[model samples]
Target: MSELLSIAQLSVSFGPVKAVRAIDLQIRRGEAVGIIGESGSGKSVTWLGALALLPGATISGSVMLNGQQILGASAKSLPGIRGKRIAMIVQDAQSALNPVLTVGRQVIEALQLHRGMDLWAAQAEARRLFDLVRIPSAGRRLASYPHELSGGQNQRVMIAMALAGRPDLLIADEPTTALDVTVQAQILDLLRDVQRETEMALVLISHDLGVIAEVCSRAYVMYAGRIVETGPVDQLFAAPRHPYTRSLLEALASLDGPLRRPNSILDGTAGAMVQQQGCAFASRCPNRAGVCSHLEPELSAGPDGWRVACLRADVAGPLEIVA
Candidate 1:
């Protein structure tokens, strides 16, 4: 299958800090890929750079959508392709949506700009989208401002706007973060349904591995600004090749499991603090070797579509593949 979106050797730098470094990722037509990482790990920055919204950020390498380069496209020319071909649902809906404007108007404006629908037509399409995303009383709600809607409702409106342009690729950065567990599941289901109906590729960036496991067919784990492990979601979850990936799963487990031991807190803390060196997880990695502190490892192919960027992958045990 041909890729709908391809990002190769892409890097985003903020003067002295490298927020993302030489990342390579792809999303095939109608496929869902997840990017999971801890806070400040460049999960959102990677896509922000792709969307050309990273202000004062220096970007290098290529971002191609449908065989066209968007990295260097002029802003004037980019809008013609941006929302129509690619759209993004930002993490914070309250800040993303205009507080002053009615949710209906905001969503219709997106349709008007890209799909070239007139006022009445755009409003009709916007109401249709509201129904599609399961927001009740669509007609009545159309007159409501952003402040009037609940957090989950605002999120639905945001998703509706993102879909208004009928984009070929959807870049969602923690789209369900503000929601409760029940609402979160519903939002994921809604996104999945929309993707299938539209035959659009999805790039889901989240800090929650469980969310990624539920929605993404393929997954990439990022650390300090680099992709540490990548593979099909089930295989990586069953047997994470990178130490950071392992720690994330373990941390997730700790959240659900009993915390009888003191090590539980310690282990969670290990996954949080930054370790800037050869290996970002070297300070806390159980299997760290002498060379791990001096040499940063490159991603190497492993079994079953698995790729790990670690010097100690050989000793990390045979990663069990989920059939």
Candidate 2:
């Protein structure tokens, strides 16, 4: 599959504070990829900056969509591509949805804007989308306001609105946040099903590694505004390379294994708080050495695109294909 979106050397900063640094990411057509990290890891900022959606932020990088450069594209050309080619669904559906307007009206407006459908046709399409997202009473729900529906249903509506654009790529930022476990599972399953049905590229961003392992084929682990490790989900989950990745996996609760005492690896604050001239994670890293404090590790990669940024990569062994 060809790349639907490519980002290289992407950096973002607000004044003196650097939110993201030298990030590189790629999503192929119809692929489900994940960006996993804790809060303030620059996961959302990376994409938002890529689409030129961040105002007053200094963004320097190349953002290519379908082999065309879009980072610094003219304002006129950019708007047409945003919703039409790459739609985004944020975490809070309640915030994204307007309270005054009916859900159907919001969806219809998206259709009219992206698909240029008339009022009647847009309504029909909107209903079809509601059904596609498995919204109950699809026709009746159209007239319902945002507050009337459940959180999961409202998220489904958000998905419908995103799908209204018929985009080649969909960026879902923490789509399942603020939901019950059952509801979160439902929403994740829905995203997987929708991606399969639509054959659109999916970029799932979440703080939950379990969610990433559940839905994505590949994942990029972010820390201190940089991609610390990335690889096939199965491998990354089975044997994590970077210390941060290992700590993240260890933090998860296991059903079958005996109780393991929690470690203090994750106890420290986020890496962003420190002004490190070298490895940002060295301060809290378990395998930290004298060299780690003075030299930052460049992200090293194998031919399969499994990459890790750590000075002692040899301790982790090489990344290999599962099959």
Candidate 3:
């Protein structure tokens, strides 16, 4: 598969606080990539920065899409790429959708903008898209408002709007965040199905490792504002080298696993970006050492593309060396 998007040395800052720092990632054609971490992990901010969507944010980076440099591009050029080439769906569908408009009208508007379709053609395509996302009574539902539908249905409508653009890439930022367990599963399955059927590259952002594992073959784990680990999901889950990654696994509650009491030793969540030069996770890491507090680890891989950035791990790169 060809590389669809490439982001390098990406960083976002709001005033004195840094939200995302030096993020490097790539997405290929027709593949699913997942970003998982805590709420403050900068998972969503990275993409928002990449797309130049963050207001009052200072973004310094290179974002390439199919060989074109998109980061910091002129505002006039972004519209051509945002929806027509790449679409996004947020977590809260109700708020994202305009309350006054009918569900179908919102999607139809996107169709008209991105697809250049007339009212009749856009409406027809909108209904088809609603059916594609598996909404029931696709035709009649066009008149319904966002509040009139269930959460799942509203999410499906949002999905339809995204698909109406027929984008080559779709960024889903916590698309299932506001749903119950069953609905979350359903929405994930729907996203998977849509990706497979359309052959569009998918980037799913969420805090749930299990959810990422279910939908993506490759995943990136973030902490603070940096990507701590990136590799095949199965490999990371089976053998999580980073202390933070392991802690995330330990945090998950499952019926199949034994019940345990809460354990939170970290002083704060992963969202804060400080001026400290050392590793951001060292403060919370159980394996913290003298070296961790002074030297930040560089993310490197050994040709296999499994990258990790931890002074405690044997991840310095092409040549293996014990810390």
TM-score of each: 0.92, 0.95, 0.94
Report the lDDT tens digits of candidate 3 across residue range 1-323: 99999999999999888888899999999999999888888998998889999999999989999999999889989888998898999879989999999999999999999889999999999999988999999999999999899999999999999998889999999998879989889899999999999999999998888889999999999988999999999888877778788777766665754532256335555535867778998877877789988898999784457899988875422211122
What tens-digit string does per-residue lDDT give for candidate 2 at 31-73?
A: 9999998899999999999999999999998999988999988
User: Per-prediction RMSD in angstroms?
Assistant: 3.5, 3.2, 4.2
RMSD of 1: 3.5
After superposition, the stretches of candidate 2 with alpha carbons farther than 4 Å from their true spots are: 258-261, 273-275, 317-323
Pairs with steric clashes in candidate 3: 40-271
Superposed model 3: Cα runs more than 4 Å off = 257-271, 315-323
TM-score computed on alpha carbons, candidate 2: 0.95
**Candidate number with the higher lDDT (1 or 2):** 2
- Candidate 3 root-mean-square deviation in Å: 4.2
